[model samples]
Target: MKSNRFHKQLCAFLVTAACMPQAHADAKKMWVQGSWVNIRQSADMNAKVIDHLSTNTPVFLIAQKDKSCEISWGISGHGYIPCKFLADQVLVFADVATENSSPEKAKNYSPTRAFWIAPSMRGLFNAGKYFQENLLKPEQLNLENGSVQDRPEPQRPPKLIRYSVPEFEAMKEMMNKGVIAPVVAFAPLFSCEQMQEAKRRQVGSSKDEFTRSSNDWSAPDAEKYPYSYIYAHDCLVPEIPKLSLPKIKVSYFKDVQKVLPGNTQIEEISAKFGIVERGSVTGSPRWALDYDTYRYTGAWDIGSYTLTLDKPVYEHVIGRTGLVAVYRWLPGIDEEPFGPSASCEEGLRNQRNGKELLSGYPKVKDALLWFQSATPLSFRTAKINSRAYLAPARSLKEGEEQRGIKKVVVYEVDLDGDGIADFVQWDMWGEPEISGPSPLLTLRQIFININGVWHPFERDSYGECT
Candidate 1:
């Protein structure tokens, strides 16, 4: 079981208080009373760690059982916690306590998303905490989970951004209508298997979207259609217009082109990612972090970029080295990068890491919705079926992950009731790395979805799919 560093005296006192219980009218809101409380997957003491609600953190109540209650403070904070940790009312005014407020957000800290339009999901069954929050009090976290090992100073704490009930309700109403498969825009239905085949080819070519390389886009198709031969192999890269790095020289972009000019720096670069997170491609195979620290969206004060395929072709990276480049994926390529490539078997298995991650964030917040989009290819500027998915914007290739950033997903779905499809959205949020990985966090850029568009719900969301 995950243990806390603080004394259990507070817990004991709360237990005593719980016994003398107040009225059963059931509180409308509950605030975490201790330094922090863990949300569990099951009521059992040893079930699984879900998330932590900081002291004085408040959440709207869903249900109350014996000792634990289901609560969601909003965004990434949703799980079952011991009801004893909360009181009947909000402790602090949220306007003053939230660091995510527009005017209060820290310089280096921004929600991992560029946009967070409220979602329409209120009446939906079990629609996790898409939008929710409460006031909070922050304090240092010892992080002494097990054996005492010195973690470096400057530890990153979680951030809580509160959203208005109206924005959330508005978004919720839109989502209740439903989502449509983006593939509807494409001519042929591209299966996930076909998408995987395209990716395997990119690795074999040792070329990615950013890397300088070329490919034969022509492919044989089982059933030919008007757009059957819409071969694609390129997309709009970071080019020069999108970079907003810091002054520090990113090894990858140290002497590159306009992408990573001579001297570049991000206001704040995580000790993690090292080069992967840099706007410039500065990664070498041996030098890069293992399969875990795959680069997610990098959103700083300058604002984040939409990591999407410019057109209809799926995006792929030639993961041969750290300087990864996006690839215009062509299904049925039947090839892999010649040198430094992973077996298709390993690659396919890696995608499932998303499942493992959700269980890690055991509250199962913002599960997932994947589909194929008719993306445009840079090479021919032709549309083709591209594999795409909308997952929570956050990811965790490391542990002790900082929390609070919410991922926003603007998508189109056909409301079953409406018949014809229309565009609707939800500000997706969740984190897998909050508790880190069980066993131990590993090194590897485990691909859950393509880097740009499909992001985790919350920052640092990771889990062991194994």
Candidate 2:
């Protein structure tokens, strides 16, 4: 009787073991679609996101539900992934253990840790040049030094292979699922300016770091430079246009060499971009990009770039270089006649929008630091750190309670002389209560027109906006 009981238990164990492989087979490999998709505790979109996976991340499917699917890394690592953000590809994670790890295993890998890259096709071309000069051939055919005679003429390395059809298909496969971004080669020191330029060219709607690439195809092919990563993914998409604003080209200025000649000349200040005098803290003058280069923005300031319309039709004081220096926007151009005086509520509004509330100096300077880091991040939407109070348009009536925000400046200026105004400097205001003793001059938000839609940017809204 005891032997029969043991036999029955052994048969049950054998049946259970046989079913395990079939259960594992039910898990189909899947890819995350958007730049990021929340890993939810349950299948509901509204359910709490346990975590977020980047574009091109791979997961194993456990089972399917109506709007979502149960994804499994291992036994305990199971959660509902939304079906809408999922793609058809089945990219799998290779676990050394052979036994599938749990969802908790996902935390062990961060696909985006070194994700911020700075490779342009041009940059790649430049890097290859660098590799040739520095690593491949340390000594060059210098007529002066005879360094070329030092070693057997270094065999010119074969030209880098163009991305193969397989690589291109890999790209299309990844792109079909999520946002595709420029894959930057990891550099010991990355350039913030270059990454910022790339950000302007990347595809996305947000302006913050990581957030900008939130929709881009997450490059899983990050390796040492000149590897398959270069030109393999979306890094070489020719459709990406050089970012520029529609400032009906009034004139282009020459880069200034010295402290702009003391002559406050009109022609010097007319261009949409120019080099200006920025004195060091010790009061020594040095040339720098225009202090207010990107101050005047429009609604069209989305994607990887913020195009501008600097050609505003000036009714009065239209050509005041000093005024332009003070308010970067033209609404502040006709502040006195077009709007109000400093003592009045309108004046405070313009001031808030002008440099008073949002100083462009620190914001622009601080951003460079981010790019210099080993992992430089770009943004679609970012915080500038300048304090701003965003609220609806309402008048400060007599005997009415005053909200935290008071007195704003909002007006349209034809920044590019296009007859149709394309830029707006709005909500520049002063709230003595929060602004403290000084009257805060800041716009509620600055809008620039792109195509037809107006995109808005506020102080502390985009990267390092102080």
Candidate 3:
């Protein structure tokens, strides 16, 4: 009889437990009221703004009887909103403490809870203070990079010169056609002697044109002859006549007759000029120029002189050490002299220590001037590519630990749509070696397109690839 009574009580208890409301299923609902509210599933997604709440506008919240209450809006056949969106809403529910006092007392009742605010309300509230702090006040918005005071002064446009009749006509024609054309002409200057010669020759047939003497030439005057004269129609200008100067011939041969003042044998003549005596004729001879005594001789008079020398002249003149030294050091050959001997000496000095000699020689200084002329310099940029492992989805139940990435092989990426590969970054691994409660790694990969290729964006010195 006692066993049957215990069995009946156990059956009754099981029935009561089965019919009791689940803690999670028991949740409360609430309505939203405001000037404007934006309904959205999550914070990141766009919100639907509701301007006014009416009888049909149904918005509510429900709190789970268990830990972490779940909230939603609308009714069946309607979409569910995220619980976090109605964090500010109130919760309502019937008291269930009277029905399951013994069981509730025996079970632990610590509850986990979460809340949400309408996305539109959150954005406005958060943005309101920020806008007021940053935008409403002018003083707070003023930026100081030192650029306001350091700006460069404005530049004035260049002045244009007035054009003459013919010049104006040419410029006008070019301007009408939308083309740029430069005008260039020669302004001939002459000296007095040249002008006189031109007049004597009666070279210019037209009264408007006459050749001026070469001596009459002067520095061009910008105020007077501002530009070269241009002609229009069938006008013609006379050609300038080239002036010719009298030709003079200077000989460097031994003047034997002048030196000796009498007839002398070939042996005596050779000895007098330091001429190397071969069997019958002298092979090489040394001679000096007496610049003071030398006079200009016309070209036609060169072959008239007959040279003769005496034995005494040979002993006294050719044996001089200075003449022998000069002939040995600077022997005249058939080839033309490059320039004055002084120029050759200067070139040698420049090759030795040019910087030290720059001040002494103005010509050398000008040649070595190091001015910074505007020229384009070449530069290069490097490109790179990389790959990243994505984060796994979070789950409620614990299982086998997720497998971490083994190796990351980064290849060059052509992010700019260019086919060429620029650079590569490889051997990447996640940070924070061990994984358990805390995340193993917070990984992020950045890429920058430079010179038409994607490069790994690095923060330190290694990032600079130029």
Backbone-clash count (model 1): 71
Off by over 4 Å in 3: 1-27, 31-58, 62-466
Lowest lDDT sum, 10 consecutive residues, model 3, at 110-119
TM-score of 1: 0.17
C-alpha positional error of residue 70 in candidate 3 after TM-score superposition, expressed in Å:
5.5
Candidates ranked, most accurate by lDDT first: 2, 1, 3
Q: Comparing 1 and 2 by TM-score, which wins?
A: 2
Give the local distance difference test score of model 3.
0.24
Q: What is the C-alpha lDDT of each candidate?
A: 0.28, 0.31, 0.24
| TM-score-best of 2 and 3 | 2
Predicted candidate 2 versus true structure: per-residue lDDT over 172-227, tens digit per residue: 22222222122222211112233334444554435444232133432332223322
What shift in Å separates residue 14 of candidate 2 from its native position after superposition?
49
RMSD to true structure for each model, in Å: 24.9, 26.2, 50.8
Candidate 1 ranges beyond 4 A from true positions:
1-151, 154-159, 177-347, 350-466
